[model samples]
Target: MFIAIVPAYNEEKRIVTVIEKLEGHVDRIVVIDDSSFDNTVSLARNAGAIVLEHTVNRGQGAALETGHAYARSVGAEFVLHFDGDDQMDPHDIAPALAYMKEKKAQALIGSRRLDEHSTVPWFKRHILLPIGKMINHFFVRERLSDVHNGFRILHKSVLDSIVIEQDKMAHATEIPAKIIAKKIAFVEFPVTFTYHEYGQGTLSGFTIIKDLLFSKFISK
Candidate 1:
């Protein structure tokens, strides 16, 4: 089975659209509603997604972990992690899966930098992302073009191997760290993100850095 796991929080406005875009791309769509205060859960269910609820607002990482567990329990052969916000292009899903098969990689991560035409914001492309890349390299020791992108696909073996411990944005770095630690064959694929009014701002970058640094400090 193929499953797409979406971690959502108060994304009622775009949740249905995200699910709609995902339809026919994967066998099952699982939406982990991280204690959304809006109509996200009901909207997602109405859109034909298998909705999983969190009583409290766990971070995106924790929500993804919940989705991961459910995916594994259902014997999913491939699992895709997609954000609830309508940023990532669902059209990239097929090519990414094909590339994974072609490269014989157990996992594939989407990279905006790999696509020359990707319209990344100036500050993000020139400043924030570069700094984030450096920090992630320090932690994972792998030079991934895009470290914090939420779009990725993992084979069953990878799903069984890595565990997401950082229950926040730091889980971005943690995922690659564990993937590298386990020596999983992974590759990066070109993908586009359509920025909108609700996209993450500059401050979130610092938050991610703080979380990563704190998590690293405690893990030692």
Candidate 2:
């Protein structure tokens, strides 16, 4: 069966729409609420998602790890890692999933390069994108255009093989590195994205660099 794991933190305004749009696209939609202070859990449950709430505010990485683990325990054959911030376009779900199935790859990462209609910011396109690509290339040995995208599909084997220790955005960096170390077969699929203002900069560039360095080399 197909499962989508959405990690949310206090996202009440748009969770309903995200869940509503994903209907018929996935078998099960699991919202992993990272100790949200708002009504994220209740809203997700009411919107027809299986809500998994964390006791404390662990970061997105922790929430995603919990969601994927629960999905595996319940016998999910295919898993889609998504965001609850509504930055990812739900329209990409169907085609990306179909391509994943066709490729039979252990993991399929979403790249904005595939979507010609994607509108990215100047700083992200000029500075952050290049930095992320270089960092991911060093670890995965593949020059991926978008490395930290949360929109991706993973087989159970790929998810189970990689160990996620980063508790924040750094998990994005850690995951591909683990996949490369495990020698898992992965492919990149183009996906469109929408940048929500509130969700775009939870952490600054310096903070992101610190997290990436610690997760990629220093701490890990």
Candidate 3:
């Protein structure tokens, strides 16, 4: 079965809309509420998602790992990792899945840079993302068009192969790094993003790097 896993943290305003957009796109919708204080769990349950709750606020990566474990438990054939915020375009889901099937790939990551129509902010488009991309390449030893895009689809086999140990934003790098290390067959599909003011700031990039280094250090 196809499943979409959304990791949400106090996203009451947009969780319902995100769930609504995903309704018919995937067979099942799983929302991992990372100890949200708001009505996120109630709202997601009302929106027809299988809601999973964390006792405390772990980071996005930990929430995703929780969702992954549940998906695997239920024998999910394919899994899509979607953000709880309304930034991702649900319309891109079908095309991305189709592309994955067409290429016979085990995984697919969304890339805004692949589409000329994608309107990325100037600083992110030119500077922040480039630095992130380089850092990911250095760690993962793989070159990808977009290293930090959260929209991704993975076959169940791929899911079984990699483990997400980074509990925070560093999983953005760690996921790809693990995938590359396992020699997973993957591709990048063009996807659109709607950047909001609440999005991660420039300083968050440094935080991600720090988390990544710490994760690597601990792994060693």
The TM-score values for the models, in the order shown, are: 0.95, 0.91, 0.96
Give the top-scoring candidate (TM-score): 3
Q: Where in model 1 is the C-alpha error above 4 Å?
A: 217-220
lDDT of 3 by residue, 20-105 (tens): 99999999999999999999999999999999999999999999999899989999999999999989998999999999999999
lDDT of 2 by residue, 1-220 (tens): 8999999999999888889988899999999999999998999999999999899999998988998889779989888888887878878888887887788778888887766766777777777778767866765676676768788788988767776787887788778777777888888888877776634452554565687666546553
Model 1 agreement with the true structure over 56-123: per-residue lDDT tens digits: 99899999999989988999999999999999898999999999999999999889888775678887
In terms of TM-score, which candidate is stronger, 2 or 3?
A: 3
lDDT of 2 at 216: 46
Which 10 successive residues of model 3 have the least lDDT summed?
211-220
What is the model-wide C-alpha lDDT for candidate 1? 0.90
132: Cα error in model 1, Å: 1.0
Model 1: which residue pairs collide? Answer: none
Ranking by TM-score: 3, 1, 2
lDDT of 3: 0.90
Residue 183 of model 1 has an lDDT of: 95
lDDT of each: 0.90, 0.81, 0.90
